[model samples]
Target: MIGLCLGLAGLVWAQVPTPAFTLAWDHTIEKIRWEEDYRVTPQGLLLGEARVRGSGAGMEIPEGAELKDGSWRYHRTLPPLQPLRVGRTPEAGDYQLCFDEQCHVLSEWLGPPTAEQPALELWSCAQVE
Candidate 1:
């Protein structure tokens, strides 16, 4: 009975999802760059540990934006979950953000797009097996 219970417990533990993905970026000070780590979670892309030259000297975690490799790729996942991707934004929009050999620009469609909010979303998500 004890062995059976242990086997069942192990099965449950194996099924529990763990943090298997990480995205990192850099912020520079002179020639020195600070590195930040972001963990991909089902709830969202969460800001994790950081190594900085000084307090608040690292890159600001893009809130609600998917952290792609070194750039923030827009996401289409349901709110609060940002899936990271690797690529550049389309080359046809007035909005653009670029820095440190990386960028996150005007891409993806979100909604009907009021003058305030646009109608687009970007980024990629995992597929089911």
Candidate 2:
């Protein structure tokens, strides 16, 4: 099994079990729901699928995406991302990180964002060395 690393202000803050996980958030501009699924790989983090409920500004439905059951679903062939950054700001609200059949608020894991900490970094623990 591999572990997922969470970093704050360039330092490792916490780690979580991450064979696969889903991140859900509401679009800041459209106020619509969006979700993405990712899996940990030796190369990095691989995005498997993305889904969004409705579309609006900055939320263009990707080409080849299918509208099914009121949501647009699609997949991308992007390379494994070494580290994914999640920003924290009043305007952007919070993110829901889920795995192991449970969901947690970003703040619950990283605590409230402060002036000094503007974002959280996510990467596979294999890179810790």
Tell me, what's the RMSD of every candidate?
15.5, 2.4
Determine which window of 10 residues in candidate 1 has minimal summed lDDT.
1-10
True-structure lDDT of candidate 2: 0.83
Global lDDT scores for all candidate models: 0.31, 0.83
| Model 2: how far residue 34 lies from native, Å | 0.8
Model 1 vs. true fold: TM? 0.28
**TM-score: model 2 vs. ground truth:** 0.89
Candidate 1 per-residue C-alpha lDDT over 14-58 given as tens digits, one digit per residue, 9 for 90 to 100: 111223323222322333333434443545445454333323444
TM-scores, in order shown? Answer: 0.28, 0.89
For 2-107, candidate 2 gives per-residue lDDT tens digits of 7788885457787787778998998888899999999987787899989999989988889999999888999999888778888877668888889999889878
Stretches of candidate 2 exceeding 4 Å from the true structure: 8-10, 126-129
